[model samples]
Target: MHLIKSNWKIALGVIPALLIYCIFSIIPIFISFYYSFMSWNGFSAMQYVGLANFKAILNDSVFWLSVRNNLIVVAASVFGQIPIALVLALLLNQKIKGAKFFRTIAFLPVVISTVVISLTWRLIFNVEQGLLNNLLDNLGLSALAQNWLGNPDYAMYAIAVVIIWQFVGLYFIIFLSALQTVPRDILEAADLDGATEWQKTRYVTLPSIWGVIIIAVILCISGSLKTFDLIYVMTGGGPANSTEVMATYMYTETFQGLRYGYGSAISVLIFVFSIVMIILANVLLKKRGNRKPV
Candidate 1:
């Protein structure tokens, strides 16, 4: 009590930011929760529809497709981005020429505007005269080139590839920083014990950065669930809605379709799904972490 009283000025300093967060972030969440139970077209008086919106979502094939596509994004991010980033981080962590330059180049995409990245990639993915197709043609791989973003069969996968490419540097920087924090003395001890690089990495380095890896996985899942801007720009959830995810679906249904309540319900489900997936990931990773090494 005395300690807190002594720090009262600090508490006073934090109160305004906390208030702002509650107003903009926390309060809106509860508002969405309330709106999820009521039917509203944004202009009309909200009608209390109970669970009808959720019921509709369950039977809505489009919503389910969005969920599936969202999961694919999550899977691609978690599996593709993290591993690639870790590998790159590991490689770059070593003493190499122009390492800083390389890191800067790798991380450039993360700092660029999402809309710009999407627009650039859209040009590259263009059916008529895209850079990718042109390159494939030059390599005598014209058969490999198809309508990259125009075809539904390949659109989502193509977006997934872009997602992986854009974010790998973010995690790469994260892992690189985490790698720097691993104790040099511990690594030296392993070296003295004649441990192979693979053995040392597996037993020492990875275990030390395991917490960061778990956090990265959770971030990837949450971010993937809320993916909108890139796909919205690149494909606009199109090529017959092949690239639609929960966030895009929510935006279209709410603002475009004007089914505010249904959109709220979708938003609520997105929140629930994010929480559930993060919890499940933590549990699974914890179990794996706890298993005795054979």
Candidate 2:
């Protein structure tokens, strides 16, 4: 109480931002929650439907397929992006030639607009006159060339690869920043004790950034759950709904299908899924962190 009173000026300065956040973010969550219990098209009166929307979702096979695809995305981001990013960060942390140029090139996708990336990749994946198929033909591996986005079996995996390529750079920068914060003195001491490079990385370097890694995992999971723009632009959740995710499905249901209340319910499910996954990740990571070194 005394601390807040002493810092009243800071509190006053924070109030406006807090109010803005409440109006835009916090308030809408409650509004969505209320709307989830009703059924309404945008033009019609809202009818109180209780759990009808959620009940329908339970029996909806398409929604379940979206859920499965979302889980695949989360798995790919966590398992593929994090390790690849960490390895890149480690390699770049060393005194390597053209490290800065390589870093910039890797991060270029992150800064590029998603629409542009999607369009470009879509072209590369095109069945006719696409770079991938052309390369395969030139290399005498024409049989390996695929329909990519047009084929249901390959569509989701192809999207997953692009997702990894785009976001790996972001986590790479994050891990590199965390790596720089590790104490050099400890590393020097480890060197004095004749520690090999791998040993030092396993013990000192990774432990220093373990918390950041956990946060990255949580971010990856959250981002994967709500992934829409890139996949939407590339496939529009088509190829027989193979690439559909929760957010894209929700968009279709609410806007195109005119099931606003049902969309709200889907949004609520996304929120719940994010919260649960993050909590599970934290619990699992905490347990790993607490384990005694063998």
RMSD per model, one decimal: 1.4, 1.7
Best by TM-score: 1
TM-score of each: 0.97, 0.96
lDDT of 1 by residue, 1-294 (tens): 989886997889999999999999899889999999999998979899999999999999999999999999999999999999999999999999999999999899999999999999999999888999999999999999989999999999999999999999999999999999999999999999999999889989988898999999999999999999999999999878888999999999999999999999999999999999999999998788766655
Error of 2 at 205 (Å): 0.8
Candidate 1 TM-score over all chains jointly: 0.97
**How does residue 238 of candidate 1 score in lDDT?**
89
The per-prediction tally of clashing pairs is 0, 0
Clashes of 2: 0
lDDT of 1 at 280: 100
The pairs that clash in candidate 1 are none
lDDT: which candidate is best?
1
